[model samples]
Target: MNIDTIAKMLFFATVRIENHGAKSASVGTGFIMTASLENGDQCPMLVTNKHVLAGAQQLVAHFIPRKPEANVPDLGQAVAVDLPPTMYVGHPDPTVDIAVMPLAPTLLLLANKLFIQALPLSLLATELPDLYTDAIEEITFVGYPNGHRDPMNFTPIARRGITATPLQLDFGGKPMFLVDGSVFGGSSGSPVFLFNQGTYRSGPNVITAGSRIALVGIIAQTMLRNAQLPVAEEVAATAHVKFAQELNIGIAFNAKAIKESIELMVSSAGQHLATAATGDGVTELSPA
Candidate 1:
């Protein structure tokens, strides 16, 4: 399989999150990003939805081991690192579904054995130039949907769709937008991107023939349809609910929310680096 440079990078950028709780086991998606500090230091963080990390007895992050001689992932050989509970940090606002966990200690353990692609904050589309001319733009997102991935290669799957809501405006008066894509239960925290190659719109009547890529947002929730029941006085006492139908639409928190979440984590008494051994003997970092 010949993967392009962009696809390969995106594949490596994502890490599978397995949440094992007392009742059941669930899966979700997360991507690596470099959070910049005021002191000019860059820290690699695992960005994902807060709900994905909630109620988990233990969290394991799956990563692809790198083949040093070939400078590529070993594919079949994967590594699982247990993440400590203290490592999780959520957005200051309880309502925000975004959270970030530091990866410095995890990277140290991986060392040269695993390959990771961390995107910098500069990629966040604080301002989408193309949005000025077009309200509906195509987007690409990478993740493990419904916990499905390459069984042999251990890589993330990429999906494409268009923006259902304008990127500049907050959807439903929140810092979010909608994507018309086949988002599933395990796609939370997937990074959304706006990728264009060849000719793209630059202005109202100007077209630029070049490539552009921007990190527009991150997947937070998938819209689902609940069947409406007939109103009855006894409905509240003996209500039986059916499974919600997938709407094929995903709600994503825009880049501004992501930035704000990072800032909130950083500003809270500064990020302290504390090293501790997990139950499985995996090294984890706890930020203050």
Candidate 2:
């Protein structure tokens, strides 16, 4: 599909999860990865940020449409499917902020056999022309923000931005842009895309040499603070009233960290495929 189309697809798979008694939370994005075993067992895996799924053994992901017409209904109205119990945790890598969860047989079936407009693996691997050259690149970021509830009813919004720099952040360090585009709390794990020619591929939107849309960073934090005035003089005088200032911020794991996690997961998966090919009854690998 085209770059614009791919951006929309990535947004649909992005979700928000509140953890730590709602005191802490994160926005995580997922993409489709289809795995084929030599023994003929083909499955689709959901790849996402590892910290997004951390702490919660059992989790739920909301799926929205890539494009929802103004006349359409909310995404929550869309059928909600429970993911199977198969969890594929990868050894957390300091360099990348990624992880993989193997789809349950049932979920895999739904993606491969039922979902109408799934993201294609081939499209993800498509190459762009001189993405890291002098060409100015435009990209779209998709994800559910704090206020967006349903996809069918509530229209998903796409934020437009350009690549200001290349992917040159220190591995395991914070990676991001100085885009005029605004993103909020729920947009943490949203995938950043770089438009190249007419197609889009996995990577940071690159604007210079050594820089490419390299799955480089995630929305980790947003700066926010609450202002409070001292209790009214009369009230303060009558009773001891205390006021405190608080700050709220957003932070995301660097995409390189995530990429490392995925590589580990893929390696483990490759082993499983090898075992399956050898007729070993679906042997699973330990988290790498």
- Best of the candidates, TM-score: 1
Error of 2 at 249 (Å): 10
- Write down the TM-score of every candidate: 0.84, 0.57
For model 1, the superposed segments whose C-alpha errors exceed 4 Å read 1-4, 127-133, 228-243, 269-288
lDDT of 1: 0.78
In order of listing, the candidates' clash counts read 0, 27
Give the range where candidate 1 is weakest over 10 consecutive residues by summed lDDT: 279-288
lDDT of 2 by residue, 1-288 (tens): 222333334444444333332354444445555554545665466665556566654456655333243322234344444543247565464434455676645464444322222332222212222223232346556555653544444334556665444344342344433333565756655655543433343235522222223333454434455555556676667444444332332344444454445446656766433221221111111111
Compute the lDDT of residue 157 as modeled in candidate 1: 93
Tens digit of per-residue lDDT, candidate 1, span 146-176? 9988999899899999999888888988899
